[model samples]
Target: MSSTELPESVAAAVDPRVSPVRVAEGETLRSVVLPGLTLAVRSRSATAEGAPPALYVHGLGGSSQNWSALMPLLADRVDGEAVDLPGFGDSPPPDDGDYSVTGHARAVIRLLDAGGRGPVHLFGNSLGGSVATCVAAARPDLVRTLTLVSPALPEIRVQRTAWPTALMAVPGMTGLLGRLSRDWTAEQRTRGILALCYGDPSLVSEEELGHAVREMERRLQLPYFWDAMTRSTRGIVNAYTLGGQHGLWRRAERVLAPTLLVYGGRDQLVAYRMARKASAAFRDSRLLTLPDAGHVAMMEYPREVARACRELIDDYDRS
Candidate 1:
């Protein structure tokens, strides 16, 4: 909602704390501290020294690790970094306890401003998609191109499968669910998520599943995990109800960057029908519909997503 620029004093203050997290062979992880926020940034080694900078944002309950499969694929074209929002991944909760879409967008804006990496290719999935939309709209000068994968935008007729997630926004529902699932194992939780998120759960390798389970286990141990999930869920719900200038659709219409919209035919959360509306909202936009992929298209079909992203950048470059 405010300027994308971070104050000089805040930008200069860097917390030295770093948490140990899994990093792929060609990727590295680090911590970034600002005034009231700290973020875990996962970066891939760019194939060239002067490649354009890019930033990736993950969905609710996901970490920077969500982009692990896709970042390396774009290494040749962009110096990629994926951020773990407050209270997700290795990043701790924000001091203000604000998990609103605007809050997350501000965190991202601060990070980019502090790093002096404006006009970067911005990519987001699901809830992160909503954040990216807000960022691009509010600070068009900071975004070069925008890509959204199964963005959780407002829907007129919500899907039955997605209602449960949306319901978490209700007061006390998060604690109730937590108590109900107190006996559930991390593996069980991971499998349930995989089944819900992936169009074809069997496509996930055992190693990948193992990593997910471990991550789930670690998150379950965090004192603020469920709180972050509940508040962020509420944020999305609140964002959907907003109208006028603050509405996500209105913001999408204001985005100036070349946009790429990816929707999964089998997505149980975001409806496939919204793709056309999204394409129409962003003036300069293209759509990619993947019939077999689900919510996390980047993770499920990285190569195809990467190729589409390349086309977006290439087309933007030519024009």
Candidate 2:
């Protein structure tokens, strides 16, 4: 395979215009239809024939675009693919209207199984992190290594700043919040999100923020934008309440793959303290804590995240 070109079959499957601006140097966007859901997958444009495969899962309210920065950085190490979970990005809602953690996990597992991409290096962020945990535990055979960035594991004392987000999952809370903030423009909403997700808002360039606003504007036009967010938010809440072997903590313990846990000290959503808990839960795990990063460390510090991932992969190769 050429370094700059995709296989004829894979090239034909990609839709170059799906997310033109978000596409990285060597990435392609394609749609994958699984048994119960259809997903928009962003993958490396070219890779060595026998390179190991790696799959990325985004958080609630985020799409495949979330991995735009990290995917290309790891392109040389693995055949990377990032999926827009059902009801997010270009993917349509599921037929059954199910958006629980298990539902999301099933969608991921099915895609991996159908594509014959199992035993992959699985990466997930925020809500995606929780879903990845379930997949790694329930079907360890499908994942070779697990990497989570600020996973939304159940917390006894939820952060005060995260309460509003958690509340959106309630039956009528989304509608209420919508009515209250209906006048806010896409730029306004994007700014608010940046504040919550970035440790230092000033670190984001104007061009990047502008692109974010444009993306937010486009998402706002989607009829199911808020629905996906609400349902997924509720799913996280429900997962937090789960007990016994099904709980996220229990699932973490069940994960057999070598794991890498990333946490941002300034993350307002997932508490930084969860990092230690997660490290302890996964038997063979390492933690990467970024004091200056917030919720989306991969975006703010892609080079750092990439270096850590490469180190993990290198260690795996040697072992």
The estimated TM-scores of all candidates read 0.94, 0.92
Q: Candidate 2 — which residues are off by over 4 angstroms? A: 1-22, 46-49
Best by TM-score: 1
Give the C-alpha lDDT of model 2: 0.86
lDDT per residue, candidate 1, 14-39, as tens digits? 23222245677887777787988888
Kindly give the number of clashing pairs for every candidate: 1, 1
- lDDT minimum window of 10 residues, candidate 2: 1-10
- Candidate 1 lDDT score relative to the true structure: 0.90
TM-score (C-alpha) between model 1 and the true structure: 0.94
**Residue-wise C-alpha lDDT for candidate 2, range 149-262, written one tens digit per residue:** 999899999999999999998899999999999999988999999999988888999988988987787677767789999999999999999999989999999999999999
